[model samples]
Target: MTVYDFAKSVVYGVFKPLYRVEATGRENIPAEGGVLLCSNHIDNFDPILVGMMAPRPVYFMAKEELFKVPVLGKLVPHLNAFPVKRGMSDREALRKGLAILKEGKVLGLFPEGTRSKTGELGKGLAGAGFFALRTDAQIVPCAVIGPYKPFRKVRVVYGKPIDFTGLRQGKGSAEQATELIMSEIRKLMESSK
Candidate 1:
């Protein structure tokens, strides 16, 4: 394996148990090739929870501001976390996500634009759906529950993949397609709760 992969694997493996992770339905994540992981956002550490539990490396789109820290900017990319500009199209981020898929890597994303400050689910953005449709990659729906600070049990539940190829048959706008994709994620998130 490459240096980056080694580093990420070790880091995640080391922290996997510290969070008291309890995951189920891992078979939902396909064994090979590109995949889009659609999940809900509830905390700043949500990415870590999912990434650590996943059987494979999963990339995240973090806000640009978060990358400004001297050490993180250098280390994040190594861990497969790229920056996304908040409140904007962030074409660069989208392009990077697509490229990762084209390179046969995994992309983990929360349809929600940001963390759920109110501890409730939020309407999801369409980027994850777009990436899946554009690359013909499978999407694994997931739900995460926990707050590491409370010393609580953290759980990440994986669900079956949502295939979007069927929707391509009927006439549908990008917006419609996005909603349909988010709806599937929503159902998985709810069921895992």
Candidate 2:
């Protein structure tokens, strides 16, 4: 098995028993194509949870700093994660993201740009929208809820794909698209209540 599959199995094996992990709306994910999974960031484990729940392999753009750590830096890339500099436009990261989509892979992204320590959804960055528009990939709005506490139930909900076909890519368009994605994520989060 690939490193990703093995790591996923190991994570799922541990997480499923320690926490009540529930996933829904997975059918909304495209079977084969370039797609973006836009999600709310709650904890560092969010990517692992989402990747475990997704129907297909999910690649994420992690912060570049994570890659500097000795062992973790060497391992994360094997599990389909690459580093992106947070708080600024990292053109290299964007190019890598676009290339992943073009190759018909599932690109996972947290539009908030960083984890929300407050447990509330934060404003989304425009990068997610820009990637969606640039690659003409469907945006799957995802909501991951619950405190990352042991024995607490964490829910990961996937919403319908947001289509941006024929949408012009520009300054205003990217902001609008980000808003739409955030709105859908909010809806999904509310539904879990």
User: Residue-wise lDDT of candidate 2 within 1-193, one digit each (tens)?
Assistant: 9999999999999998787898999999999999899999999899999999999999999889889999999998999999898878999999999999999999999999988989899999989878877776778999999888899999999999976654544334777888888999999999887
Encode model 1's per-residue lDDT on 1-193: one tens digit a residue: 8655677577567556577678898888988988888888888878877877788889989889878989877777777789999888888999999998888888999888888887567877767657866786778888876665544677788888876777665545556666776777677666766
Q: What is the lDDT of candidate 1?
A: 0.78
Backbone clash numbers for all candidates listed: 0, 0
> What is the Cα-based lDDT of residue 123 in candidate 1?
78
True-vs-predicted CA distance for residue 73, candidate 1, Å: 1.5
Estimated TM-score for each candidate: 0.88, 0.95
RMSD (Å) of each candidate, 1 decimal: 2.2, 1.6
